[model samples]
Target: MIDCLTGKILKKTPDTVVISCGGIGFAVQVPAATGGSLPAPGREATLYTVMNVTENDVSLYGFATEDQRACFKMLTAVTGVGPKAGLAILSVMTPEKVALAASSGDHKAFTKASGVGPKLAQRITLELKDKVGKGLASGTGFASGADVPAPAGAPAQAVAALVSLGYNTSDAAQAVARIDEDLPVQEIIKIALRSLSRT
Candidate 1:
């Protein structure tokens, strides 16, 4: 039931972070979208959280923005979707893109996520399309300007590589956008790796 957490970032990895609050450290799994926005370790950050409880384990998922958290909640509500799967979807696609894909019945886009298959992708679109509009209207879906930063120069090429590696277009674009335009290809790759690891 923890709605949010504010603390010093103690550690970070591609998909996980440890935040220290009140002398206790909390490990939170986050989507790539949220991971890219995180400040460096030792900085203070706040994340909206969704706590998932089960018979055998408990996990906390964190989001950089309320919109992303809302999207996660919506995604997990589909019958066959679990928190990890929802995080995988968010890691690949932004909430806005996800809404568009669902509304437009773009099963291919939905299936681009690591573990999502054709049937589940189609089912996601079928079950979530109508609900997506509500989230969009409420401003809980992806905002128009919400984008990850990417590095500079040959962005299109880098993005293509990332897409080939299974990252969705939005994620690739954002990661590439964060790079400086003058950076060399190797530097760009390094930055992108750093960005992806935050997820």
Candidate 2:
């Protein structure tokens, strides 16, 4: 199995990238965010990759981070979710948001993806909820983004506030979730911002 690829980017697109390693160019499909975050063509970059093989087809998918690759593995492990659908979900929502949605049982959040319907969205949440919860309880964030429950109330408001200030949703949620105790909305936002700024 190909664990990852590190090479000069020969081409980069929203859904795929061509990385020239040694004397070969490997074309790997990727989520929009991963493609967007990668260095421009000709620059050296690394992608955590998973190769999927079927009876007649072989495909490779890549991610910018190990967490994202782990997220993809967990997503595709679902009964009805395919590789395309998994990338679609990750393209729109980061791993942190996926964990947040599962933790809160917010199936509607995933409906924003292009091909994701309510039923599939609900299944995704239901299947991953246990994994997320167990990972949090075990203090392991390998697949899930956080090892804690998603913030709510003042913390939720703080997350929104951070998002409005141009922070990424994943970053905002994680920062708020890290604050163990409850605080006022302002305090939550303040602490979250401080946490985010440091990252």
Candidate 3:
């Protein structure tokens, strides 16, 4: 599976790098983050890699760390998100931010990636809400600390309040997940409504 490679860098471009290992040079597509982290040409570096194969082409993608590779794999699993788009997202946002956006249902944050529109952004967050953390590279946190982990399940009253405000049951639940459960129901509703309004 070519899980990883360590070698001297032979060439590099904006999103691609060629590393020479055992006299063979391998070309790999990389996210901007990985690209920026890579050492200069002639310098040795190690990359965690994934090989993608299809009907007519074989491609290799590399990351500076296994966590970023894991993040790449998870992002590509979403419907309508191909490797290029997945790389595009990682190019702009760190894995932690992506995980935070998914956990908090902040679809707008994903739209900052090139070629990611509102619908795709929403689908990415909605579909990954429960699944993202498993593969997320740990240690990535929002600098603002707004991506606080949520307690499982949503408070019924909070869900109801958001629903009454025109949010779907699922979205309301997702938004309410960001609030502290210890707070009063009214407070939960108020905070959830405010968070949803931002999305």
Q: What is the lDDT of residue 169 in candidate 2?
A: 52
Clashes of each: 15, 0, 0
Question: Which candidate achieves the best TM-score against the true structure?
Answer: 2
**Per-residue C-alpha lDDT of model 1 across residues 1-199, encoded as one tens digit per residue:** 9989999999988799899989999999999878888999999999899999999999999998776787788788888999988999999986656665664457788787878999989999888655543333333332222332111225445555665676655555557655674566567657887898799
Off by over 4 Å in 2: 142-199
Tens-digit lDDT track for model 2 on 144-186?
A: 4442233234555665567678876556656766674357889
**Model 3: clashing residue pairs?**
none
Each model's lDDT comes to: 0.73, 0.77, 0.75
Number of the predicted model whose lDDT against the real structure is largest: 2
Q: State TM-scores per candidate.
A: 0.68, 0.73, 0.69
Quick one: RMSD of model 2?
A: 8.7
User: Which TM-score value belongs to model 2?
Assistant: 0.73
Q: Model 3 residue 136 lDDT?
A: 24
Residue 195 local lDDT, model 2: 80
Pairs that collide in candidate 2 are: none
* lDDT (10s digit) by residue, model 3, range 20-61: 999999999999889999999999999989899999999999
